[model samples]
Target: MKQLTIVGAGWAGLAAAVAATQAGWHVQLFEASNIAGGRARSLQQSFAGKPLDNGQHVLIGAYSNTLALMRTVGLKPDELLKRIPLDLRFADGQGLSLPNWPLPLNMLAGLSRAQGWNLKDKASLMQAAWGWHRARFECDLTWTVEQLCNASRLSPRVMTQLIEPLCLSALNTPLNHASAKVFLRVLHDALLGGLGSSDLLVPRVDLGELLPNVCVEWLRTRGADIHLGTRVSATQVSALQHAASADSAVLLACPPWEAARLAADIAPKWALSCAELTHKAIATVYLHCKDVGFNGLARPMMALHSHAQAPAQFVFDKGALSEQHGLLAAVVSACTTERDDVTELVHEQACKQLGLVNVEVVQTVVEKRATLACIPMLDRPEPFVAQGLWACGDFICGPYPSTLEGAVRSGQQVVTQISQVTHR
Candidate 1:
């Protein structure tokens, strides 16, 4: 049997292991952290007797690759994720929320019925949507999202309520720096890709139970070796060439920095690209109400009117989604504030927006490097770093930005490339 050594047991590493093992390869998976899930993992610390995620993340129905991966590991998406039609309604019900209708109709109906939008605003959005659809959702590689919005003549109302939040949540980068081409790809897939493609898939459970924990068990039962808290050093990876046979390949699914360091001596050019990748931070502030259950949000999740002082873009009701009563999570994408400031600002914002009372900060998690900046025309590192040595992660060159789906697709793509090389 062919041997595959996978370093880093995050979603990317785990996905690769599953794919490789299913294809009749012996897999050895190693993780430096005690647990998997990487940036999206559940925290060890508890808040109100329930663990909070490192950051609150949601999936879209368009993420077919991620959904398929979950099912491959004996998990059901319908059970784990709460599916609802594309809803971006604010607490005051003054935003876009698509009905359960099909494509084109849903978009038309949603736009027509959009609250706080004048006829001119609705017409402007529809015209822009038509233009994008006509052009097949392609845009110039050098153009930023801000440039696209300006060129499309999107209203300030639409930009704030729709485009800004969507861009930040998807790319985790500011509008002026985020790639327009990548953002369009996301829109095209979501808006035009069949029924329910635009639906939001919010997690009913924590990040760990959503996929990683179950993935480890699935791989182990299939006889793949799993190693937790095992950090593979640069020297150790370099020695693999002499220690292992030519048929044995190494897959680095670690973070960009670690991958760059491990392959620096062998693949300088690839390492440089990986090392040069810039990232943005995401902060999730968990809050709990002492008086009563914090179920005051109009929906399970509601968009916030964000500004300089108000850092959070969206807030989630943990009580509604996960049954963690009185708990709430406010997410600040592309966050740049200090921890204390985030807590203070988010608490204030949530109380004012959702009209909650006596809410205290439970925990504040700020992933300093949550995701790649995803700026326009980013030159991400390829999967094939060297002969018999590869890399896979959200940072890998791909159509999508740094996301769970991107990470899974990159990992699976590596295995396909490996198979083709060996066969050739």
Candidate 2:
């Protein structure tokens, strides 16, 4: 049997390992960290007194690739997460909830039912959507949120209540800098894709328990070698090209930067492409507020205004995950300010926003480089970085942003490429 070595046991690496092993290849997987989930892992902290995720992550019903991988690992969709309709509660005491209606119609109904929007606002939103749907598809490809919101007749209320939040959450960048094409792709998938596609799937357990841990067991059962806390410093293609090589292929299923560093000696040109990939930082702050009552707090996730009293972009209640303590997790995406002060400011704001003045300080875990910033118009590298060196991650060809679904899908793509190349 052919042997395949996968570096970086993140979602991408794990997915690649599972795919390769199932294809009858002898697989060996390595990770730099002791944990498996990478950014999506979960941990138990003393202060929180329960398991907590590295950050608050949600999977939409639109995330077909992610759901498929879960099924591959013997996890049911409903068992690992709770799926709910598209609903969001804004900070200004106004909220909008979308029913399971068809694509743009659901958005229209949700906007119509929004608490504080005026008729003119509604009309402007429809006009914008109509124009967007009718505009030259090529022209739509180059649009940005700022341009769309400004050039269109959307009212400030509609923009704030709908467009702004969706843009920030989906693009992970502020509206001004976020690419219009990427934003539309998200809307196309969530809104245009239909009602069932918009359902939000919130993880019920720690992220590690959800996929990576299960993946490890599955791979082991399939007779694959799994190594934790082992980093592959250098991957030489010449070694694979050796006359008496034992391994059939090497899959560098890691972040772009790491892949660039390892492939410099193996594939210089592909490494150059990897080096061009850009990344952004995301920080999550967790607070333990046992006595605080969050009866009115929005769903597990909601978009936040940067200028709002809180520095949080989204918040998740951990009460359902842990019965011993009420854990609140806050996400700060594409953060450019001082990480330390930002955490403190976010904590203070969250306490005030959630009415948790008496909440105790829990552990704060910061993911400095959580994901590669998916900038608009940026060229992405192909799945086959080199003849034997394969690349798979959220930053690959799946989509611009490095979301969970994108990462898993990219992995599946790389596996297909690898299978085809090896068979040849």
Model 1 lDDT, residue 419, Cα: 78
Residue range 225-317, candidate 1, lDDT tens digits: 999998899988888744555578899999999999999998999999999999999999999877565445668888999998999999988
lDDT comparing candidate 1 with the true structure: 0.90
Candidate 2, residue 393: the lDDT equals 84
Q: After superposition, how far is residue 344 of candidate 1 from its true place, in Å?
A: 0.8
* Candidate 2 Cα errors over 4 Å, as ranges: 44-49, 135-141, 235-238, 241-247, 290-298, 321-324
lDDT of 2 at 256: 84
What's model 1's TM-score? Answer: 0.98
lDDT per residue (tens digit) for residues 186-241 in model 2: 66677565568988788877788789999999999989998898877773444653
Residue 210, candidate 2: alpha-carbon lDDT:
84
What lDDT is reached at residue 32 by model 2?
84
